[model samples]
Target: MNLRQLEILAAVVRTHSTIAAAQDLGMSQPAVSNSIKSAEASLGFLLFERVNNRLIPTPEAQVLLADAEHLFLMRDAVMQTASYLKAGRKGSIRVAATAELSESLMPQLISRFLQNHLGVDVSLETHRLDTVLNYVETGVSDIGFAMEPYPRPTLDQTPLATLDMVCAFSAKSELGRLQFVTPVDIDQMPMLKAGSGSRINKLIEEAFQKSRVAFNPSVDVRFMNVASYCVEQGVGVAIIDELTASCRPHTAMRTLPFRPRVQITLAAVSSNSRPQQRLVKSLVKYAREEISQRLRQVSKERSLKGT
Candidate 1:
């Protein structure tokens, strides 16, 4: 019936006498007798038979003993698993990041995390901004990096970084010579859309609306990789995240600072129902440090240009 009762039963059978079982179990004879009596009352079966003042276990007692021992063993196994997780031992982490974050930041952050927790497996996916948000919302992934900032009421969003869209063109392009382009110039340069449904797109639209700058997109593409490929091929001028500018810097493409441009907010999103994350949260912490480093570079460059 109860664990103590089952243990008492086991001790009684092994010791072969109630008096001996009580001494071996560190309990009084009356205590062991009460346990066995309570257990039989609960299960409606006598677990032991008295033969010449010795306790002989019934058939049902043998079966109950097996189950009782198994219960304690399984409980120990569960406790060990919890200990492993708590100590940051073997397990897999599932993360989905925006294409922009994936390019420059995730590689180094993940590399460092992997070095320490070698036994922890990381499953990383590159996702579109919109896709990243949906994945986090639906619990498809444990953590998500996204710039497709829309309100997710159920999800807790932590804004990690804010980046500006920089112009990308062939090294030979006219605007690449200038350190930075003004809003008026941004209007004149051929626009290459970074696709629809992104916080960057909305910011661009709002910036243009405020300045009343009329510009037409020369090319439209999804996936930052593909858009950068278009820039590499000299398709047209494009505005992209700074990560795109940093990527493939020697690939016959040039980066130009754009003004009144879109701002991309990189956020880490996870569901409210998510378990108290240990490793994944540590990754997010590292990512924040990386963002700080990047922003410092951006600020330094901007200050030097002004001076």
Candidate 2:
């Protein structure tokens, strides 16, 4: 029997009344009755015995119910999957990000994204800044998050925020007592800087040069979390973006605005050679809004603290 006949058969067997099954199936009682007759004729067997206006399933019909239940389950799954796909909720997004952002920003953003897109899965990879850009450029990753990635002809960049540089140090450090830390304040202090050649590092160098202070750093680290940890240990004062400082709020670490007001762009990088998938587009939009909201919260907190 066809699926329609099988549906009516199961409904009739379940409700034990054509009128009730018809109401459940949104069909007239006669139409349900005709469907049952057609199914019984096609099967060359009696599927139900009618007695006293009640339908009882035969032994053969009971066996078919078991298999029909499976079929109905599969049908429901297919329909739900189709609906999720059509609504841009079913898909996997691959992201490659620099270690700094992968640790600090992407986790919160991905958690928020997952809460909304229940059927979506995320794959996050942490790499160096250059490798992150390469992953997006070569299409190995759908998107990459980085701080001010260099302009590339093969990639698209979505600016999320322009974050100011902040000085991270132990709360007990003398520098923490100041309203703002400058290159001059940390000129001779042990300084923890990011790896050489990074965009933020370049900006930091420029700021120091403009201030005519030595840009020498006592240590070089690859990730902001590590730098924050060192600062918490009272190793040195590190200059990091506001995003990372805000995210890694170690109780022993305090951040002060670093002057001469060095700023860097936090951006989402993707391949420009091909169209982004709908899921990727939605994620980018969500990331933008989430970052903006977080920045506002940070600002409000800073304001309340008179910072």
Candidate 3:
């Protein structure tokens, strides 16, 4: 029988009377009696019998009562879980981010997101920028954080923030002696850069070209954090994004503003093929706010230092 009929059967069984069942269920006695009659017709059996003017459940009705109670319990649980998800308090999110974002901002971003949504479980992975895009496009990840992702029809990009490209070097180096660095300033120095075809590398190339300086890097790494680490070891000066530069591997690593102000947009990438879930949207919102707040703190610290 239908859920409404099962509900009426259970209520009538519990109360042992149509009037009492109707009162308990907020239904009329005639309506409850009619529902029982309909259920009996559908099942081709008598669910109740009149004995001494009392409604007594038959053996078949008794058998269904236990299962009906279990089904009701399951229904209630499903509804409660739905409520939790709708409120953005329950669910799991699988996230993939490039090495720079994962190393620099993702730890605090995840911590703050979990603090706000205590019931959400987050799985984070670090990949190269290209792999991050692939993970999202291939449905291997729910969300991706990348810098200046190229346009793709299969992927939807949401701009989170615009960050400057900075010059990172060892504090003991001569480049750190300058207030601000330019393409001409470190054109001939041992230079570290991202992979040759990357967006940052293209921007660095253009900047050096505009300044009439050579754009040769002694080391071309896949991740900005790796470049930042190399700069920490005094291997070479790195032209990397602001986020990686902020995550100094050692106190001796220093960052300076690169002249001409190369800027890149950090984007939240997701598959356009998959429908965005409420929990994923919540996580993105949290990421945006967390990044903005952290950047503000970084700016304040830099201002205090007069850099």
lDDT of 2 by residue, 1-307 (tens): 8777888888888799999999999999999989888888888999988788788899999998877665674465466556657888658778888877877788888988888888786878898888788778766677998888999999989988899889898889887578898888888899898867887888899999999998999899888778888888989999988888888558999988889999899999998898999889888888888889878988998788778
Return the clash pairs for model 1, or none: none
Which wins on lDDT, candidate 1 or candidate 3? Answer: 3
Query: How far out, in Å, is residue 51 in model 3?
Result: 86
lDDT of each prediction vs. the true structure? 0.74, 0.84, 0.84
Q: lDDT score of model 3? A: 0.84
Supply candidate 2's per-residue lDDT for 261: 95
Model 2: lDDT equals: 0.84
Worst 10 residues of 1 by lDDT: 72-81
- Model 1, residue 249: distance off in Å is 2.2
Relative to the true structure, candidate 1 has a C-alpha RMSD (angstroms) of 17.2
Displacement of the residue 155 alpha carbon in candidate 3, Å: 1.0
Clashing pairs in model 3? none
